[model samples]
Target: MGLVRNRVGLPAKCDLQIKAKREVCSFEFHSVPGDKSISQRAIVLNAIAEGQGTVYNVLRSRDIESCITILRQLGVRIAWNGDELSVHGQGLRGLQAPAGRLEVGNTATSARLMLSVLAGQSFAAELGGNALLSARPMDWVVQPLTDMGAVIEYLGAKGCLPLRIQGASPLSPIDMEATVFSAQEKSALLFAGLYAEGITRYRQRCQSRDHTERLMHYFGIDIHSDNDVTFLKGGNAFCAKDVMVPGDMSSAAFLLAAYAIRGVDRKGSLLIKQVGVNPTRSGFIRLLAEMGLHLTLQAEAELISGEPVADIYCTPGTRLSSVLAEGNGRIQSLIDEVPLLAAVSAFAEGNTVIRDCGELRDKDTNRIQTTAGVLKAFGVETSCSDDEMVIHGGRPLSPAIVNSCGDHRIAMTAAVLASSLDEPSIIRNCGCINVSYPGFVEDLSQFAHIDVLPAE
Candidate 1:
């Protein structure tokens, strides 16, 4: 209950307070958005290829919608009903030049991937995005595609967006090494490799998500990876299949973190069913499990949809141990979950050192810095370098006002911290949760005391 104002005799702002319950409460069932990353890739690949394909369980987020809009501008017909999306793909040589500029707002994947394909076309196309996307580094995508004989001209800043890709003759395949560990950059090259004259091979310094490769294979595109090197030969036809996108594991991270921190009852432990559990993207889960989280993976199966799916059941369990993030697939898989994992570390017993995630430093470095700042704001002692964060754990967390910085993972992470508190904690700029899971606040309201307040 909020304090009443005596002068006006009316209620003022609502104050949220978490009360201690005698019994433990847990979540039994919950569902999140359709895989946003997968949906974006599915739409882009199917729309640009030479087949009529149906994509089911597509996420209807703002980013994905931007991709669809761009595809439509490129003369691809898209029919969508709820989560079911059908793309009448324009063949390799089927695209017509759009009359005006095509804008992709804050969707880096859409902007980057489409730029690669547009490079292979024979028309001049301009691509731009919102402030955030414009500020994102495109040189990783630009340099590789340019080396493949795509002439891209940057109109605004060097190696940034508001760029123009004047379609020139597609060049023969060239072996290149990806400098940054960005899945989008790798996928962009691979997508261009689909139309290259000869074989195109990509060697990466670090492994990123392989959804693009998995989807290409599912579409009958031959893409082979030997160790860290991926080879894709040109002159191949893509056979589209009916893809069923599972729930996004990234989105599920918040629920698992909340349940772990809040200590849900046995019966109410939220069953996040049928989520994409591709081994390449399970680093966070692996870390949590290593830290002693009571997580269960059931009905695990491989899908020809280019990704893997399984049922993830997470209930309340003992506090986890501090985990040191090692190299290999761990950093690449959980690139987006670093913030939440950092919060998880706050409750652990030892020192947690997350290292070798330098690639993440390219994008949202401020978020990483802000995450460390928030930990300090919450009374948790932490330190972070450019590429790593070391958090000393087993510290008591007190209620404090924290800023989300408009990052979805950070916002949800703050909410998870709120759930564990006996007192009220205010989260400003937390509305960014809609970037992925729009129902976050509504769904969370069922479990904890949450009041959605405007940023003051």
Candidate 2:
């Protein structure tokens, strides 16, 4: 494989060098990063619980850091000693008014979930983020919280951040009907419902990630799910306890994809330890298996904090074929991995269609367009519409410079794709990978020859 460089000559935090068709002759065991979703939820719930709580194996990334920073601004006492995070819960109504606006950085998870928590407080505060976050819509949470009698005003463009919220001491119970299958929206409402006067019922056509529900149950909160609906009664007390966050499945998806695309050639097997395989978030594994990837679940599968945990083993499959990924109710489970999946589709035998995923456009960047752009740069035939992406597979990828668009998933996906190609490809804005998987370059380096250098 030959090396390629970016033509823009822009300075970057990290540049990756991936040798194509690299073979790994030895078995590999990797301990991926802790689950960011669970870590964020644990931090928020622990801060509002009734006593002191400890979270182990929490991810140390920019996204998690944003959550910690906002919690501290709201009077939650949080301390980090290496891998252990300790939080002193002040109870549901115990949060003090922030002295200044809460800066959420570029994390939509922090912005949306924290917005709901702020709605039940008794003081007024402002929520803000970076330029990228400021462009993503916040109306999904704002509209529902407003219906429950929480006063929120958009400080910037309508339906987006920065938001000025005047909280209600006793929020009104809401019968919310979800218009989209979004985990962030559902979790936000459930979080705010803790302060309502009666039961807050959320009904959706499809299920999203249930981390909030599971963590609530783990912390002794009263929450239940019926068909198409999750209801939480207000005034339930949360008891503080220690939580051990499992390894992030989303981060593991990149590794799994790398092995799926190249393991047959490398003649090696990969084992990822202590990964959270929550059914609602395991769509990547399920979908990849359907597309002819061989994966095994170790016998140690168990439950952690009401979530499923297991070790994932990946090996090369006999053949690769295309599969359909529609944006039905199940899209929430695999939303973060769609970009990586699209990249892998380049190695399949037939056309892969990803439809009904217009929601990808609303992320940190236009993921559907960005995913297609990356594949196209590598000489793959791809096309994208408002709600669908089609990748014509069976074509060998060529070396070319690809842009990460300042998005972490895209950066990691590009790196994975580059590793499988026959020539070297440059990934611009590679440092954005730190937002979710700061250790991605380091972890992937174990299996392949990679070099990290300054962009220019």
Candidate 3:
């Protein structure tokens, strides 16, 4: 049989099988590239703004590149010089309708966020993506846009993608109530509301990440929130501003978990300098502390960018404890870290149960199941239902080959397990690690001895 090589030249198959006995070793990793989430937003916002916008330290990943492609298709002038990106936008309400269909691949953020901007236009547009992107829920955007008078149709599953949106008369103000608190949904409504008749009000169960609201304020747009409602007035023009995208806390969780499991100094603790510590996205930090992991945050000095930057110092400590739902809910602010946090749980002393993460189940059940699968391969007992994964720890993981299931987080978690194992193990679909951390293998090489063996 032949091996499969992915776009980034990662090994086709990553299977972890014990070729020898277990050996313990430690290593350190450096910082990763610019944040993916911020990169997507930066490109979209720059495309919609009036003047030239400069984005420094932008990530050039698949998802972010999808956003850049959509922006360019809509008549924006975008240039990239190394890590610096320059986008010349047509200002609010500046985009001319594209002559044909605009395809945004694999990235739901690109499809959803850009759809909102498209809603305000006096033209028609169709949005489609890769199989996975088309499968993601779009009713989140459909419901609000339809309520505000935008015409949209789901070409596939009821609320899912393969969307055909015919731009309508600019939206009328909406006193909207959301069925779920999704940042993409909220941001979509806010973008569509920019061309509405009056003030558009957003009400949801709880607050989401708030990147949209914060960026609104940054661009001199009129926005306000009270209780559970956020308001955006129509007839507003957003000014282009230079943005400094910081390191992602979500990405930082991998390094933190590696440090906590393998002993930071023993494996050489990683320093992720000047990462975005947006309170909404720091739940992992809080949850780790609550679970009794030792992590130090330094350089809390404020930056001119309106977001806080800090140095993260993490060292391995005693087996961390499980988090309760009430506490987990408090840190639900950073829900994306739950999967990697499960890996940390596998190395903990007691049962580490994760609940109130039902939202995650809907997005990547295959990936989550892969986490449980990897844990089982390493001799960690785990129980997973639709919503949560319960782990029983304190058992040293045995060396075994596992699958990454085409998920980057899963690939990295498997790598972490491989680092602490004495025997050579295989991780199938290891190429998935390129989705987020492109240099993951190189960084992981610093921690443990890993061979890029070809698949059978």
Candidate 4:
């Protein structure tokens, strides 16, 4: 099955319209899509477990679909009966090699995580992706796997995709401190560790998302984390359990930002229900709070899957302030939301400087450059560098046509920013929003003036 596209009468490549004259973003409660990170892991990890596992509340986005499709290609049996996903695993050593090349279009998460699963398999498998996914940095994942005895050949370009991967049986485990803050890389090595005999140790300077670690424990794998260190015991088998995915906080940020802005058509608190508010993953909330947006959380019972869910309450701010984004943990937490933060900062009183963002250049397009485009579309100006952005706020937003850069986040950010101003604006190539948040245009249109149409 292909990735799900936008369902609100949108063409493959569509444009988004945001008119500020629509109903204000006032509501008592809302729910976004299921957590994409958790949903992907729940599907991939459980598919390799010893028995059949059922996953609930899975996000049926294009990215998750990519992971599911690739896993099915690798011989896992997965079926969706209504909202429940039934995945039957052949255990740690039972995964079958695909008959042909595995195609993962525009899904870096699926491609990267699947690399580790394929790394320890006995046979060679070829993995390829679309043009955008091919350009992402796979060397970060490859070099580490190569160190562990996996034989990887680059079919296209070095450090890029279209790779021919051959497994290394009884792979060598190593102890090293991670130089990059990547949960995907960390998860890949952890998966590789499952094939090795000894204990595998991974250390990081700061915590990224811990969903992988959490899910490992949920599946009964012998994995533990202390401070910045993580240890995984190899040669262990695990069983499957029913997993519940919480609502996506990343998706909630756009709505909360609309209500939190000073002069949007909003007057009250926006309640977002049943969101995964994991501290390491919910840094966007803290980033907003730092800029004087009022937000509170009512905690929900932790899922047996180790995901923490909560209801978020956000009130629009009267006075906004500048923010500084630094440190590895802070950078990782708000990484996906930086573009949205930049768009929201345009109405703040001062310059919001974001640093430690060199990784932004590695996204679908150059996110740093695209975020600059977003800020400019909002009539905000500032200085930009390879790793830093200073958004000058308090400027009058203009009615402009902004390019989506073929990026879902950029398109969503532009649309969210435009909803707060009186002028109507257009975001080109917004159909990309379905990559992560399908039906986003329809969701936004209920509270804001937005429409999806064929791209010019």
In the range 332-392, model 1's lDDT, one tens digit per residue, is 8998888889998998899999987666555533666878888887899998887889999
lDDT of 4 at 42: 84
Cα distance off (Å), candidate 1, residue 237? 3.6
lDDT of 4 by residue, 4-117 (tens): 323343466888778764443355545678888888888888877889999997887788878888899889999998657899987877889899999998988888888887
| Tens digit of per-residue lDDT, candidate 2, span 1-456 | 111111122233877878654555543544668899999999999899999999998888888989999999888999999779999999998999999999999899988888888899889999999898999999989998998888999888999999899988788999988877777888899998998988999997687888889999888888899998998998766788899998899988987887777747565666777889998999989988899987888946656588778888767767888999886655677989988889889989999998878888999899999999999998999999988899999887888788788888988888998887666778877877878887777566655667776774
Name the top lDDT candidate: 2
Candidate 3 local lDDT, 1-456, one digit each (tens): 111111253544544332321334433333456677777777788788878889887876666777887888788899998779999988767787777778887676778788888887878888887775666678868888887888887777788767788776667888878776557677788888887878999886676777777767777778888978899998767777788777777767776766666643354344666677878788888778877776778877654556676878765555677765433335357677777788777777788887666666445335457678889988899998766778897787887777666666777777877776566778776655655666566555545666776655
Give the alpha-carbon lDDT of every model: 0.76, 0.84, 0.71, 0.81
Candidate 3 TM-score over all chains jointly: 0.90
The clash count for each model shown is 9, 0, 17, 0
Ranking by TM-score: 4, 2, 1, 3
Between candidates 3 and 4, name the one with more favorable lDDT.
Answer: 4
Q: What's the CA RMSD of model 4 in angstroms?
A: 3.1
Ranking by lDDT: 2, 4, 1, 3
Model 4: residue 392 alpha-carbon error in angstroms: 0.6
Please identify which of the two predictions, 1 or 3, would achieve the higher lDDT against the true structure.
Answer: 1
